[model samples]
Target: MKTISWGIIGCGDVNEIKSGPAFNKINGSVLSAVMRRDKEKAADYARRHQVPSFYGDAQDLINDPGINAVYVATPPGPHEEYTIASLTAGKPVYVEKPMSLDAESCRRMAAAAAQTGTKLTVAHYRRALPMFRKVKTLLNEIGDVSLVTIRFFQPKASALVANSEENWRVDPAISGGGLFHDMAPHHIDLMLYFFGEPLSIHGHSANQAKMNRADDIVMGQLVFPGEVFCTGAWCFNVPKEFASDECEIIGSLGKIVFPFHGNEVSLHTGGEVAVHRFEHPQHIQQPMIAEVVRYFSGEAAENPCPAEAGIKVLTIIDRFTGK
Candidate 1:
């Protein structure tokens, strides 16, 4: 079997254990290098994660011939640049979503991937989660999916007020927007995965909790290919809100409820409900990152999250942002 080595561009929160360890554990894969702007932090991450090399600059790691792919975990603002650079270098990229702040950058990255003949994948990790896969199966089992609803409610601004300005999420330029852009891609992508493209959409967002640049609360309605209706919202500032990621699919036979009890899904059928859940102990990034290794080795048929899928999500996001 061919071996695939990986270099990670941003060795921050997401790479801790879930993703970093998987490179070494997955079949015929290795996490050979890592990079961060801070030299000491990058070196420390490399040491801790058992990566063979570390660099203070991203380009240095990407240029490594031993590295077959690069994972970009930086914030949304710079996703386009690094991802395009990696693809241009003829290395597959598994970038964290939202792929870019807007649609045009997504197009540019996709075009870069096509031009270079390299695999460009987005880390829409929800697709790799086991429980969500079951939901997809249940949907297929029960035909005539008519309505879908996904709700994601996070904390208010003050509630999550950081002592330092280092928390870039509050800045629209860095995060793309408020919770909608930061968090909605996961939910919205699930909508697209379960159903098809949304025919049309109408969206409204407001900074009810007080923030800069964009809305903390956003709600939108999407009409899917079969006239399937999906209503999704990201409400950040309520008197009380839990970290909720939920979806309800109402079908002719029955309805499936993915009540955000951890990352599991529940089914409601025959006037009674049963739980169908599979918890991924690893962080969402690991399996998808590992799969890229498989794709490169010809052990896998396709990228787990293809560039086109990210483009579709960006297309929807563009409609929401009106650009």
Candidate 2:
């Protein structure tokens, strides 16, 4: 694939701006086609985005001779099916985060890619964000790391607490679990990128809110290869005033603090503190999509966020959720 002519499956909200526009914006990349279960919506998306074609069935998009790569932007439930089909059609793939519904599905997707010799990557786009890169730099400046902690507390009124079947994020049948399954992958993937695979992981989760079948709270600890200790707590039933989203990394010399959802990165060392704030791009996933294009075009050596790395994060989530 010298130039990446892309076809996207499940062009929903995520595709509107986060990724869809990026395909055409990147060098040597084109938004050749798109697929959605709703033909009207798929046609509308294609017309609005200036894509050449649209399809009502995934296989039609996958088999499009004009498309050289596929982006599986659907929900977690069908990721493995669409991804494997795309690979079997001899096209590289860029699937959305959480990789698949479970570890076994992730492994199957990975195996399919291996079998077909097609490149596959997950949209753990945070790995390519400026704010996260700043965090990595601050970690390096903080010297030898000693411990790390992640905390996420949300008010009861947050949309994530919705228990309706319409809210697929909390619907286990489609989403695999709750918002934890949807959101935790970003943070966990970053943790894996910063520190290698965990040597040991112990964690637990519960439905403290009774708002949904999925767990609204989760707590876990991970021991990394260099004796680095890490802990994480996520709760969705906190008071509005008590809500928080932060991560702190303590090193032998000092510590760094930042929020996974915020723009600020703070560093404390030598009795001095500094804060750096990074504003996100309008099309947040464009940078990462550019990297993916580069990899597919053979301009880059490796995919930044590969299926193997994503599977590791899912495995960690499995240990916490007992799935």
Candidate 3:
């Protein structure tokens, strides 16, 4: 099998732990190069991760003949431009979440991938997590799912002001919206994965915490197929006591509670409750990164998370914002 040379674009916080090291860990993938707008910062990340090369410009990495694939870890704003550039250069791309801030850019990305015939994937890491896999398995363990609720509460973005300008995420012109576009994409995608398309969406958002010019908190109500209702909120103002991201699946026979970053879930059935701990996997990004390498080597089917799924999430976000 051919080893895919991977180049990382945007070496920032998300790259430090979430994905940067996965390129080095995958069997058929090599972390050949990384790029950041700041040469010093990029060099720091490269040295820390032991990557072979570092570039101050994305074009430098994209133009490298040794980089068979590129991973865009930057903010959602520049996803379209960088992804299109990589694909046009005949390189596969694995982009971060919320592929773009709007549906139009998402469509353009999907079209470009199709035009170039370059495989495209997104960093929807939850689909590859063990606990979420357990949740997917137990979807039918109880009975038909009736309601799904996901709650993510954290300290308001106002409190932690780091990286406010390093990335374009907080800027409405670049990021589209605040919490709704920035963080809720994962939860929305998971909802679509568990249930089908939502027929109706009714919700509201507010700049309660004054995190930015956009709404700091968003609450959504989605009516999925088969009457499976989902309600969720992205609040950055919650206290430390309630700081967590968890999803609850309520079925006809039981209820399942999955805590993010935790290995187990609480299941209650027929008035009998039990705790189920998942078998921890190697790492969150390992399988997903490996799968991409395998795909690039012609040893697998199409990438699991495609651009269409991302477009759907963007549409849902638009619905919430009346865009």
Candidate numbers sorted by lDDT from highest down: 2, 3, 1
Superposed by TM-score, candidate 1 places the C-alpha of residue 299 at a distance from the truth, in angstroms, of 1.9
Assess candidate 1 and give its lDDT: 0.78
Q: What digit string (tens of lDDT, one per residue) describes model 3 on residues 62-174? A: 99988989999888878999999999999999998888879899999999999999899987777777667677777877798888887877775433333544546557787
Runs of candidate 2 with Cα error greater than 4 angstroms are 159-165
Top TM-score model: 2
Query: Model 1 segments beyond 4 Å from truth?
Result: 157-165, 241-244
- What TM-score goes with each of the models? 0.92, 0.96, 0.92
Report per-prediction Cα RMSD to one decimal: 2.4, 1.8, 2.4
Candidate 3 C-alpha RMSD relative to the actual structure: 2.4
What is the model-wide C-alpha lDDT for candidate 3? 0.82
Best by lDDT: 2
Tens digit of per-residue lDDT, candidate 1, span 223-318? 998879988877776555365667788988788887533656667777777776576755556666666777777788877888778888877877
lDDT of 2 by residue, 210-241 (tens): 99888889998999988999999988888988
Candidate ranking under TM-score, highest first, comes to 2, 1, 3
